[model samples]
Target: MNKQKLLIILAFFSIYFVWGSTYLFNKIAVSELPPLFLAAIRFSMAGILILVIAKLLKKSIKITRQQFLNSTIAGFLFLVYGNGVFVWALKYVDTGFAALLASTQPLFVLFLLRLIDGKKMQKKSIIGVGLGLLGMYLLVSQKTIATSEGMVLGIFMMLSCVLSWSYGSVFVSKADLPKNFLVSTGYQMFISSVLLIFCSLAFKEDISTIKTISYKVQMAVVFLILFGSIVAFTAFNYLLKVVSPEKVSTSAYVNPVVALFLGWYFLDEKLTNQSIIATFVLLTGVYFITSRKRIAKQKVRPSQKT
Candidate 1:
């Protein structure tokens, strides 16, 4: 195969396996570290690493003023509220279940397109929205989950994170960003890291805890920074440019399955029958929504899962 073809295959593996594994990594990391602090560190370190790599490659890190503001907004939505808050929710929710909930992003994107862009939802998309809602209700309304302490709040906050990510997806499409995709990603991570630091302090998270963090949590964070944030994300952007978005969006289907399996196998998180059924229903809806020809035609980057 040509080098380009080989890279595409490797990129697909990175996104499919690496992005999926991030949920498990985040779940492991959050067991000891404060969620906001953990995310701030991950993003800050990953952002710096990315910028350094970009500079070594002679890519420009400069952006227009409007681009800077847009990057900050995107950073807040995608990284701070979207990812940071989602990690906080993971403290209560199971890693697998959280991945299932996040699978609804395409559904959220479909709704946002209709509401904000005044675009009409096609028949497939409408049916997708219906199934998506049903799947969500079934997933969260389980008796066991509802009875757990703080789970209700966790579920609510996780949904809010999905909304934040959905809105960020829409915002990014219209926003003026750095010409280089890697640079834009770096800025988003860097800017969001700053915001997350403030969030950690505002919540009075003990910063000193990092001094005693376990080897496991430290390794998880390192994996998240290198594989999740940098490698998988670069793969995602690369795939977006080379492959059809429809093909790239297939990660949505694979990621949750990978997360669910890893959580079950490694973390021993239970997988109930309802969750299994909900996964099927929810992913089917996501398929219906994203399979629309017009949506597939647009270069809509589905935000990172973890």
Candidate 2:
């Protein structure tokens, strides 16, 4: 295979395996750390690391005013609300359940596109939506979840996170950004880190409590910053420009499987029969939604401050 092909394969592996495992790691870290503050630290450190790497590689860190504004918006949508808040909700929801809920992202993307751009859905897309909704209902309506404090709210917030992430995906495909993909990713992460710290403060999270993070949770945060934030996330953004967004979104199917398995094995989280069935249904729906034949490739402008 060519070098590009190898890079693509490696990138796909990063998003598939590394991103999938993040749910488990996030669950581990948030068990002790304040979620928003944890996210702030992770992103801030990762962002700085990426910029340093960019400097070593002689990549430009300069961005236009519009690019900066766009990066901030993308940061808010994708990181602050999509990821940081979602991690906060993890305190109330289990890792596997959160991952399963995230499986509905393609459904949200289709719906959002229809709403924003009046994009017509294909027949399979409609069926996918129906199955996605059914799976979500099954997953969320479990007696265990219903009785758990804050579980319902966590589910709702997770769904909102999916919506925000989907919209960010659509937006980034078209937005002008820094020419260097790594630089753009760094800007977004850095900007979102600032936003998340304010959010942590607004929610009255004790910033000084970082001092209290257990060694185990601290390690988990390190894993998240290194593998999840830097490797998997950069791979995701790179894939978005190289392939179709629909293709990149397929990571949703793989993530939950890894999460469910790791959560069950490592954390002793339960996997109910209903949850299993819901996973099957949700992934099947995702398959259908993304199963359309390949068409003309519209590269995502090779920049993703969007």
Candidate 3:
């Protein structure tokens, strides 16, 4: 196939494999690192690395006030809230369940997009949303979700996190961002890291505790920074340029599968029949939504008299 097709494939693999594994990493990392502090460090380090690279490349690091504001908002929602609560929730839930809940982001995005843009709902997307919701219910039903008051609070926090992420995604699409996507991403990560770090300090996380953490957990943190932040984020931006946004977004559907497998393999997490069925339903829905446009285009033929 063409180079564009190859890049799309590479992007899919990057997000599917790297992000899928990130759930496991987050679960492990939180065991040693405080949630907000871990996020702060990861994004801060990645941002600085990317910022240095941008300077070396002579790319304009200057951004407008609007761009900075947008980035901060996006960072707060997607990073501080989205990923922050995710890391926190991982403390209370298993890797599998966390992945399942996080994967519901697309459904929220679909509805939010319609509301923000006053766009009509596509039939396929509607079906996809339904299926996704069903999958979420099945996935959660299989697990004996924690009933403690703290766990209940954590669940609500995670749900709020997902909504914030979805909202931020829509905002990003509309925002006047920097021409260099990588540079823009670096700025966002940097801003998010700073914010999270202040929050971490406010909570009084013990930095000394980090030194006592296991080697495996430290390695997981490094992997999350390198693979999830740098490699996967760069790959995703490249894929957006090479392929349709819709196609690139399919990673959302594939990531949960990878997360589930990794959880099972590494954490020895149970995969119930309910989860299996939910996976089938979710995949089927995603396939239909992603293919719907092409399928409709194919239906129009020269031979048909209109």
* Residue-wise C-alpha lDDT for candidate 2, range 1-306, written one tens digit per residue: 998789889999988878788888888888788889988999999999999999999998999999999999988888899988899888888888888887787778778778987878888888988898898888888999878899999989988888888888778868998978789989999999999889998999877767888898888988999998888877877787697777776787888888899889998999999999999998898888776542123332211111
User: What TM-score, computed on C-alpha atoms, does each candidate reach?
Assistant: 0.97, 0.91, 0.88
Show where candidate 1 strays beyond 4 Å. Answer: none
What lDDT score is found at residue 52 in candidate 2?
A: 94
Show the lowest summed lDDT stretch of 10 residues, model 3.
297-306
Write model 3 residue lDDT over 85-178, tens digit each, in one string. Answer: 6787778766766666666666676677578767576788778877877776676554345444455556667777878887877777677878
Give the best candidate by TM-score: 1
Collision count of model 1 = 0
Residue 202 in model 1: lDDT:
100
Q: Rank the candidates by lDDT, best first.
A: 1, 2, 3
Q: Give the higher-TM-score candidate: 1 or 2.
A: 1
lDDT of 1 by residue, 1-306 (tens): 999999999999998999999999999998889999999999999999999999999999988999999999999999999999999999999988888888899888887888898988889888888988999988988999878999899989999999999989999888889988889999999999999999999999988889998999989999999999999999998998898888888898789999999999999999999999999988888888888778765546674578
User: Model 3: residues >4 Å from true position, as ranges?
Assistant: 1-9, 146-152, 289-306
For candidate 1, the 10 contiguous residues with the lowest summed lDDT are 296-305
